[model samples]
Target: MDESANKMNKFDVLGSMNLRTKTLLAIGLSAFILIVVVLVSFFIDPTSITTDWSIMNQPPSLEHLFGTDWMGRDMFTRTIKGLGLSVQIGFFASILSSIIAVALAFLSSFNKYLDSFVSWLIDVFLSIPHILLIILISIALGGGAFGVLVGVAFTHWTSLARVLRAEIKRIKTSEFVTISERLGKSKFWIARKQILPLVISQVIVGTILIFPHAIMHEASVTFLGFGLSPHEPAIGIILSESMKYLATGNWWLALFPGLALLILVLLFDIAGENIKKMLDPASAND
Candidate 1:
């Protein structure tokens, strides 16, 4: 290669090792841990235990790493179960939201009238606070984990739609897209062949970025008695139950679950940031 070309390629590679990509790698480690926690919980009983009141409320003893709740249930077990439930809600809801966002984004580019209408709809959705909308939807749907999933999915689509729309608009004007248009390719053909591939990385980044939000929001709503059913073995439900005993000096009741949530959220957040950097055209260009 020419010296200039080689130099440019080196610069691009160095820039691609950006903050966002590094963050994504860190987040991936968290995801692996979270996955192991879930698998263990599924294979072994999250609720199975011969209660040992002697271990109750102990702080990180070798015998009981996370200690025991007031009910003598293993805090470690409950933490895994709660984290699993929260992750499930996050995963499903984020997938649904990403699909909705992608469809609306393409629809916005399909026709001018549809574009205007979709833009307006996106604005309307964006104007609402996601948490409140999620709560309202939960109540409307009778307030359960199912409701929380649907609620968060619906409310979560707006920002993604906006991002995808902007990204789509950019993609549609690129050289290959222009060339395809000049050659009389069908809109669907151009979208599939020229547009979708270009914007896919952004979509992936958006999906990952929203996952933690969905999980946290689901937990929050459930904890407040609006998302997951109380009887369900969810992290939020366990947290809510633990809150009542917090003043009784049984702090381990809530501490483990909360820490689990924090770790998972931070991991996903960093991963998403990294994916964005890796996908950035500006960095790639540089």
Candidate 2:
């Protein structure tokens, strides 16, 4: 009886935590699931993704789950591998973009002149259609993984930069920061010790928020034939190839890969939103 009562008390305590903590827990679990998928892909053999003419266009069955593509590749393995690769690219792109945002945001907060210039730059990028800019940049760089990385990295920074800029401006007027300045602390010293720490959480949340957009944009550019090469088993390429077979009644070709990509994107989206809410004091009670 005592052990059961203790277990119930633990559950009661968990139930009493603020909404932010509950959201954080959900985000952690979602992230863990994604990580497992990425890790599992590493152990799957490369040959499994190669063409096998004997299995061509086979529907989903016990022998080949998710069906076999026209090229006889296992759609299940391909989808997992493609989604894993997308996640990797998205992770790197998000980090690169976040770094750019942090650098510009710090520089912009330095003075009114720099602030106006950075704001103008952000406006310039924002004015251009996102997909168009991505296509232009990817083509300029010769349309490969490198081009996609550069395009995604450069284009995704504006919103996060703006967020960081607002946060830094607010922190700049705080009493402790003002006191530190009067006490002869160098600007760099104060920033390193105080400002950066305060902004780190926002930076982290911003990076997480940027991830799904990066993945989607990368997939979009690839689908439009301006991103990754055809040889790669990217989700975009899978979906693109599937279109040719769709009219012939091989719906599983497009269905499974598309659904997998959607689910992966949605997982990241949910995690990002939850992290954002958890990090926001205004949402603490929600």
Q: Which ten contiguous residues of candidate 1 have the minimum total lDDT? A: 18-27
Model 2 stretches with alpha carbons more than 4 Å out = 1-21, 282-286
Give candidate 1's TM-score. 0.85
Q: How many times do residue backbones clash in model 1?
A: 5
Candidate 2, residues 56-122, lDDT tens digits: the string is: 9999999888999998888999888888888888999999999999999998877899999999999
Residues 211-242 of candidate 1 have per-residue lDDT tens digits of 99999899888888898877677888888998
Off by over 4 Å in 1: 1-28, 46-59, 281-286
lDDT of each: 0.83, 0.90
Return the clash pairs for model 2, or none: none
**How many clashes (backbone N, Cα, C below 3 Å) per candidate?**
5, 0
How does each model score on TM-score?
A: 0.85, 0.90
